[model samples]
Target: MATSYDYVIVGAGSAGCVLANRLSSDPGVRVLLIEAGGRDNHLIVQMPAAAPIAARDPRLDWAYVTEPEVFCENRHIIEHRGKVLGGSSSINGMVANRGNPRDYDAWAAEGLPTWSFAHCLPYFKKMETFVGGANEWRGGDGPQSIERCPATHPLYRAFLEAGVEAGYERTEDQNGARHEGFHIAQSFTRKGRRCSSAAAYLHPVSHRANLTVLSRTLTRRIVFDGRRAVGVEAQTGGTISTYEASREVILSAGAINSPQLLLLSGVGSAAQLRSHDIAVVADLPAVGRHLEDHQIVPIQYSTPEGLSLSHRLKGLRRYGIGLRWLLFKSGLGASTMCEAGCFFRSSDRADYADIQHEFYPLTAEMGDPEANFDDGFMFSMGLMRPESRGHVTLKSADPSEHPAIVFNYFAAERDRRIMIDGMRRTREMAAQRAFDGLRRAEIAPGPDIQSDDEIMAWLRSAASTEYHPCSSCRMGVGEDSVTDGEGRVHETEGLRVVDASIMPHNVTANLNAPVVMLAEKLADAIRGKTPLPPSGLVPH
Candidate 1:
């Protein structure tokens, strides 16, 4: 790698990889993409069903455990962020969900006109090549390839039928026009292999002479000239090095690290920086505030021994599935085992869907291999728009220290009420007649647990993160917002943060797909190009 480039992007995650591809598309621009982890070309990373293992594997995932959450019985949730090339996309459940369009409209409602769903739709379309074929609502030609999951299993059918039996509509497309209802999920998969951001964007053009990727390098801090970001100081295998940016310093290191890096670089709250002995460059008090994440409560049930995905993962079948994927890229190994999910309102009082459900055909944790004999299915739901907010702050000035995270989950009364409703609603749906053929008994909060108080008690003991953490460096025009709509760090020159960290709020679904869309939109803004015209149709 050279001493300098047009764009020096820190963190080759979902957003950085996209920026590397898009920014480097211009042959004249020299782009440098640096990652703190090694290459993503692993068999475990490629197989779809192995996502759980991939996400928990220390080699790829930055397995961060949060500070004690008082609201959830003081339990510390384990959070996973991608450390490898594609970042979380490489290790996440490859569900291709765009969330509700209303999510973006809410951002526009909060003074970010350019971030409205109407304005963001074009970019979303521009990033994905959905195999279902694109229309006004989907994309046909794009970098990330998405395919509909083959929800052919009887359990999948039961779940879809159960949702309908529970009185919700059976929408054909969850990512398209209808965002509310039960449906088969679409995934970022191409002919059975996981299609991550690196797989889709970076590797394809990595050979270009103007583009350089420095993996296994941790960016310690951003080098600044007064208040302007000029370059990045990083460490590779204990040897410190610096790389300059001729045009800009882009940070797509994700929600946790983006803000953490800003603070470490002397750009956060002055008081916090002073305590750490770091000279404050820009006193952006809201730098690490407003952290948002989804707190999911799983409701599980017993199913026929051979019906659940667990049955396919144990004994000889596991090896057979792996061999099939290794050979023809098909079978259970080709699936994420998260074939179906649902979106619906928790109550009639709510204006939109407040709860999102992920249907998993297994009772065991996604990562544990020994528990494959546990034959059961489950569905998990989280309040889409939570009221509680949290932050990321430094434990010390040391660059190697992982920042302390306080999710403060379920701190608001509304958050608790909605989640209670979500739990009951999930149980109600699973109890429908369509589930009769598969459902044997309720495994969690069993048949005895009834009433609001009982459900709330159970939730406190079981709530866990859906792995969607964002908005720590949210974009807006208020003190709570850390950046502008263009992802430009407020009051900083030649510096930008393009990733989930800049989301105004957590969307109603998985983060990886929307994170890709966010990068696609901001990449144009950074290049100073005219914004894409709004579609002007509000379907959601």
Candidate 2:
């Protein structure tokens, strides 16, 4: 007899892990969580500052690079995604910002019912257990734990001081009422160890009799029975297997792979599918469209003597940090790859606060090479609200084939304008009197690099993704929308998408928290239950 499940959730990532835990809580429904990666119990993943190290380990990461672009000319930007059980959570900077309230309201205004800021705030509360505790708007007793950075680097003080001098206030909570200030980023860590979604949602339930987490199992495609999704075909080792979903199949395979899987399973554009010899399962042209990502221009600065993580870090200091992590679970090791962040509307913009800057008191390349040193207090600036749209297309008919991703970043005039605004704000913040004492020579887009054209050209050549890709299978009520507002595949009987792919648009902050909230809301929507209450607290 084929082993069947009441619910089959593909991709044991942020959303999938949450779904696995929440859905299986009933015990009546047998859930199957399929992961393409392995266990996330590794020490490097547990150590917060060690995230950069874990990102380089092949066992924990799916290191992907974008295809060279005519716009990029020569630079091939690398896109990193976690391949382990925790998914990107194991590799992410761990800064947990739920995004601006306006971003969600904007989605609701765009025809996605119940996706308004009011509707989402509750789910955001329900998915988190904040360490500072919570108010009516925030949850104090959720499965996923959230905490403030325990130890602050000396350079962090410099960055925060700089922001204040630049006229930015020190906001108590970036996740609360006011997001327009400088603050120490709250991380998804507990007692110095990473509290990845897998650690919070999947690990505890992996031993459940009602749930089976299949790691190292690569999903090939969604098996169909005419109009409905009946099962998933995947490969484990050299064996090809099909697992039936008695109730439904949820694709938590993320934005990139979710749409790729849909296209491979013949659910994309008619012209494209036919050319690839894939029989059309659905004529959804938007299966892989409207992709958007935050483009970051890392502003690295040299610290004023003995103040940088780079300076405080060396020889026995490295040994001491390692030992402290292994023993007390407290020290420099207990920190995210990035520490503080600030969000603001550029003085240059009349529109919404469409630019965000992240303060990293440590220096390292965005990805890989554990031994490579690029240390210092480096703040990265990103365009928060982008109007650019892109697409994902399968290169071939084979399910194993990688899809072609074209971000088309700065492809639109509005997008380029936003990048320009972001760069200006970055400079304004860096040039503040607070940083004047510690400021060093410009490492990127130097002083000579001024003017809108020069900035845009630099952006096109130097700016790279923050690794947040979304909206391939965007949610909307329109026919062009791949999924409905409730996250259901249009006209489909028993399949839904509950990952970043379902986002109507990218959130103003990191998408991780919003992704978790979406899954929580989806679980409630599926079970016909009301979501939790919100944290009444506002940013101080």
Candidate 2's C-alpha lDDT?
0.81
The global Cα lDDT (0 to 1) of model 1 is 0.89
lDDT of 1 by residue, 1-540 (tens): 588899999989889989999999899999999999999999989999888788878899777888998988887788888999999999888988888989888999999998888888898899999898989989999999999999998889999999988899988888888899998999999999999999999999999999999999999999999888989999999799999998999999999999999999998899999999999888899989999998887688998767787877888989999999999999989998889998899888788998998888887553232224367888877778898998999998888889999988889989999988888788889889988878999988788889889988888888888888899899999888889988999888999999999998998888888899999998998888888899867684
The candidate maximizing TM-score is 1
Per-residue lDDT over 1-540 for candidate 2, one digit per residue giving the tens place of the 0 to 100 score: 336998999998899999999999988989999999898889888998887778778898776666665565546666778888878988887889998887887898999758877788888887889988887557798889998874355567767887788777788888877767888888998878899999899888878889998999889989999979998999989998999998999999888889988888878788999998888988888999888888787766665566667754676778888898899998778867577788877664544567777777655556333534455567678877778877778888776666787777676788777777767777777787767666676767778889998877777777778878999999988866899877889866788898999898898898889999999999987776775544344333
Worst 10 residues of 1 by lDDT: 364-373
